[model samples]
Target chain A: MEMTGLFFYLVSVLIAGGIYAVLCLALNVQWGMGGLFNAGIAGFFAVGAYASAIVTTAASDKHLGGFGLPIPLGLAAAMIVAGVTGWVVAKICVRLKSDYLAMASVGIAEILRLVIVNESWLTNGSLGISGVPRPFADLVQGRSADLVYLAVVWFCVLLVYILCQRLYVSPWGRTLRAIRDNEDSARAAGKDVDWFRLQTFVIGCALMGLAGGLSAHYFKFLSPSATEPLLVTFLVWVMLMAGGSGNNRGAIVGALAIWFIWSATEIFTSRLPPEWITRSSYIRMLLVGLLLQFVLQKFRSGLMPEKSPKIRSD
Target chain B: MIDFINLYLVPGLAIGSVYALGAVGISMIFGILRFAHFAHGDLMTIGGYGVLTAVWFIPVNPLLLLPFGIALAIVSALLVDQFFYKPLRKLPTIYTVIASFGVALIFRSVAQLFWSSGNQVFTSGVRMPMVLFDTFRISELHMQVIILTVIIAIALHFFLTRSKLGRAMRAVSDEPELAAVAGLDTERVVRWTWVIGASLAATAGVFAGMDTSMHPNLGWNLLLAMFAAAVLGGIGKPMGAIAGGFIIGIAEETVTYTWFSDEAFISPSYKSAVAFFIMVALLLFRPQGLFKGRLL
Candidate 1:
């Protein structure tokens, strides 16, 4: 029984890690390949999560949805909704400098959060939506159900990873890298910098939406807490930076490694005295933050540094 | 008229003072360092908590211990710069921006570790408003906040325009490469930037605490508004930030006032959006800002 319990814990960690991998890949598409700094992964994630929750969950008068759609449809809806939202934001902000874009995106995310909280009819407010369905929940039960979900999560990660990998080497991806590396030169070369950036932003945000939908199904519940920027935005950033920015494999590796560190720290923090129980989370956060500083200073390119294809001198 | 003066205008200006104080720091840092400095708001958190901790020891009026808080914030900002930011100065500004996010987390966590996450107030219960001319009523705290901000603004203006270091700072912001060519002490200006920025942020934090309650998220919750004010005033312009702050603060407060009927013009919960709206509109229409600040 203890072995099974331990196994389940490991499975859950992997599930969460897989979701983060998808998010990292999404981010890699933007910040890594496109050189677009999207500081509001949480906002896009929230949009996707609530969209999926409302679509997949059984009829409830409390919130907006009674769709009772299939899990696949819910996931598709998540991507589409998030992609459209990203398109709108990209139209406005993609032309700005990286720093300005970051600030603008943060503002948009905050506004989205406020909307989630204030517009209770749509999101059920802070109360959140429950009974969110998993992909194969009716078929599998108990530990096996978790194993199935784990497989599903990893499958999504694999799909996103493959997508990102392909995009990294594709001509389109090369153009993006050109735009990111030297916008003036790229523009001089007849590239539509703004349009390329807009496309990259939308794609990245859509992937973040997929991750959010996966997490919603995994948790079987959705709440405002799920969209917390500390976890959704900053942590994903740390993962990408720690693993590697431009490399697709680095995104996956960074996601799992950082997720492990994040989860393992909880074990140590849980052992703190009763008074420190409430403060343990903060300590964990401090540790993660310090780790980022250390990583940034020491490993500028991250663990799996980007190795761009070199042009032959011959 | 009295109700508008007492209820909307006074509170708006008071809150505007807080935003202006914080925005000045953000603007200066952006102008000089060329990064958004995501952690500026967290620096304000350090100030409020600093005062809170000091009050525990002295048990005086919170305002009396404000300097200590300011000093604490300055020290913290300087340390952060020395340790985290100074090394990244050579890299792309994105590195520093990302590092600032991490630093923000660290500051908030430190506050949470030391003070706990719950809300803390300097004094219990509310103070009565002072009645002026037997018609208009205003909170003593609000009056003090506005007056102190005005004084600070005048001092800041003089310091920026008159003081040697202040002029040097502006020079660095305008053209760092040129400033260095002109033999200005860029490092010293950077250090002083942190000092001025941190002190003002701390003052804003304490004032914000006085206006409401101090929690771990106090400064963070107001971060959007401060950034909006900074951008609205034009990036890198301190005086512009102050004006932008007041405009945003007043708009935020007055927008919710019941002008036509009993219902608010907008939901109180969405007041934060007002700053965001103003910022986006400004970005769309006039990226150089009202003051014709730096385009970058």
Candidate 2:
């Protein structure tokens, strides 16, 4: 591959990695910090992406959107929609135990996807919506669009990371940890467990939505199929589990590593002999499964544990 | 209305019987282990594949293959328990759940690689088609399903109530630690539980494959439906799972007939969602499930 081509691939991988990193961080907040095993993160992500796509894109001649708002405002709309959806799901699910919650979330995710697929009037259905505008397209111009978009995405990633870090060390973080470790104990200590969980879930879902919006904008298209359970949801879970669930830095690293492996495998395997490459697609799935098994067995806690601050003894 | 009941209701019952069998297995595992074994559905898929593979090798009667398929499914279940579920027993329940997800993924991938992802039709030449007057027709296959469901339910009831080992299994499910302290071999019971559960799931898978199409995702897709049944009937209650499965299956079929113009367009994809909707509704009003009794 040429240098520019390689750079584009790298940028693509980084973009995918960044989006997933955001997803993982959001999941970590819900699952690791709040002890909410949210199997429906993809639903919120889809909602955000679709919401933003509809808002910023030219209003369809037949359907909603084409308001053509700026990217920032679109992102905000995505967050708001995702947050509200999260709050609704959390309210219904928070009353249930873990297993029921997982089942409910999975159901919700499937339902959301179904709505996206079937609601042709709103989301353009299976045909999907395209021609989404990228940030600063006019300024960057031409082939530089990719690089400019990459820079913009990374900037947003850094901002989210910093924000997450700040939240992780705050008093709110301590309360979340306490709740995660022992909800009953936290409740006994005058903590409103339900409210705390709801807040955390909403925040995490908002981040997830924003990531989805960013992804849609980067791809310049939005499709219901793009938000399928296996790809958008299960892949994120795999990334988070492999990276160390609670640690944001680990999440980012894991996302990057997995994306690199996935992309390279696609490239390398396709370049191999016809017979081998023909079979590589199956092999690739097996590899992913094996890698997940390996990670689960060898490094259940992931590559990096979240860093805790030093305690000062009085 | 009478014709509709005869046509859809009867067939729905047969389909529901298969769901019941599958759900019983799933409920047993969940009640005892306290985790959603996401791979249970895939185990059924594997069983279906096993039956398909067995039929290809030995040109046995379809009826004969059913038992063989069940046996193969039992072995697969045992293997999964040994390698995947057993190791994670000491870890948190979440780890075991996650491991099961991995196991399911691996099984599906391996199945896809070996058998190919294309759907396979499993047929038993014993096609004694029962025609109950043109529109209100019932097939021998449907009869077989109902008979099998009844036999299994009765057998399970007897085993749990009468047999020492069955009682021990119940004891373990009720309270593992207490059962262990009370001189019951919990590990042995758990092993038997997997054996029985997997066997039931396999039986369902084989029968289901015969009734419909056997695909790699057949079991996995049916999982949520099984879950709906299990949860509705009260998780871990074998009889409840049976009832829940039938209710869900019939409801889904009926709902499709009532709501949609083309039954084909209704799609099985929505079946899981329908099941979940039912479950959520149940949970909202009655968290303990319909047949409130001893779950495990």
Candidate 3:
């Protein structure tokens, strides 16, 4: 490929990486800090994307909700919707231990996908909602659009990074980690374990929803298929686990690094001669799974192990 | 009434049998080993494809050739345990869950790489429907599924209760530390659990594939619902898997009735929703399930 094409591809990869980075951070807060296992990240993502899509896009005769709202408002609404969904699920499931929570989350994700696909009055069902307005679209056209979006995404990533780092050291964050370590002791110390867990779960889902909205506007379209279990949900878990969950910086770097490997590998494998694509793609997936196993066995704790939770001011 | 029987009840029973088979595996692994065993579904998928591969070469009827699939499934289960779960056996059971997720992905990819993502059937000829209760109709394949399910259920019950190894297995599950102190080879019992569980899972998957169509996602799609059945029946209780499976299956069929008869919120696509909803409700109200299975 030409140098310009290579450069553009790299930029695009970074853009995708930015979206994943936001997702990893959201996961870090839930799993890394609170010890909550949410296997349905993609459901929240799909919800956010469609929620934002409906609010901002031109009203369609076929489906509901096209108020042509502002981009920020759409994003905020996505957060609320995802947060509420997470809260409801947490109230029902967080009482159960880890494995049950994981199963319940997966169920919710599947249900959300079914709703998006079957409930045609709202989501356009399969064909998907399009013509989503990109923020600052008229100002930057051509390749510059991607560059600008990347910067915007990076800006959001940075903002989340600073906020999370602050939260990580704060007393509230310390309490969350303590609760994760031993709920009984934390409870003995008068910490409302369940309530804290529920709050953190909701906040984490809201972040995921924000990331989804960012992804939707950047793509200028929304589709039900994007909420695949393999593509978004498990992929984010792999990123957070591989990158080092507890460390905020680790989550960002891991997202970009894994996204590059995942997308680049896809491009490379698909371009391989026809005789190879069918076989090679699956082989790649196997290798990725094996890579995760190898990482778990070797790194054990992960690339950037969780920083010891020192109870102090940032 | 006959139409309803043919459409809902018979299909529900068939579907429940598959869920029961899969649930037996889930409950056994969860109850005894104390891990979620996330890859159990993929193992089922592997079994179906394993049978398909074996039958393809051996030229045997899929119904009669199930033993070959069970054998392959048992080997895969042992390998999965040795490679993934064995290393982290000492660690928290939660870690096995993460590893199982990876294994699930690996098994799925491997199936796709080798088999391709095609919906395949065991044999081409359609089974003619037979009279069941005067007006109700059942196909040869459907009858075979039910008959085989009953046979397996009976065999499993007998083995768990009467056989020496089966009793040892139960003893270990009840109290591993005490059982080990009492001279039970915990390792042998654990191995047997996976063997029986994997065999049952593979058998279910192979037949489910025959009943419907074999695809890469067949087992994965069924994973959550089967877990629901297992939990509903009680995690460690094998007999519970049967009752849970039928309940989940019937509920799944019943959920779509409103949509079929009148415009309603629950559509056919939301059939999977029924199992999850019931599962959640059960957990909330009765964590031990209808049978006296432990919450864990």
Q: What are the models' TM-scores?
A: 0.98, 0.93, 0.96
Q: Under CAPRI classification, how is model 2 graded?
A: acceptable
Error of 1 at B258 (Å): 1.9
What would you estimate as the lDDT of candidate 1?
0.90
Clashing pairs in 2: A57-A66, A58-A66, A59-A65, A59-A66
- Residue B220 displacement (Å), model 3: 0.3
- Candidate 1 wrongly placed segments (more than 4 Å): A310-314
Q: Candidate 3, after superposition: displacement of residue B99 in Å?
A: 1.1
| Clash pairs for candidate 3 | none
Q: DockQ values for all predictions?
A: 0.82, 0.49, 0.75
Greater TM-score among 1 and 3 belongs to 1
Residue-level lDDT tens digits of model 3 in B1-296:
67667877788888888999999999888888987778888889989988898778888778778877788789989998988788888976777888888888988998888888888888777777998667878887778888889998999999999999988877777777888999998778789889999998898899789888888888888888898999899888899988899889877876665435566436677888898898889878987888878776
- Kindly list the per-residue Cα lDDT of model 1 for residues B15-132, writing each as its tens digit: 9999999999999999999999899889999999999999999998899999999999999999999999999999888889989989999999999999989989998887999999
Where model 3 places Cα greater than 4 Å from the true spot, the runs are: A312-314, B258-265
- Give the number of the best model, judged by lDDT: 1
Docking class of 3: medium
TM-score of chain B of 3: 0.95
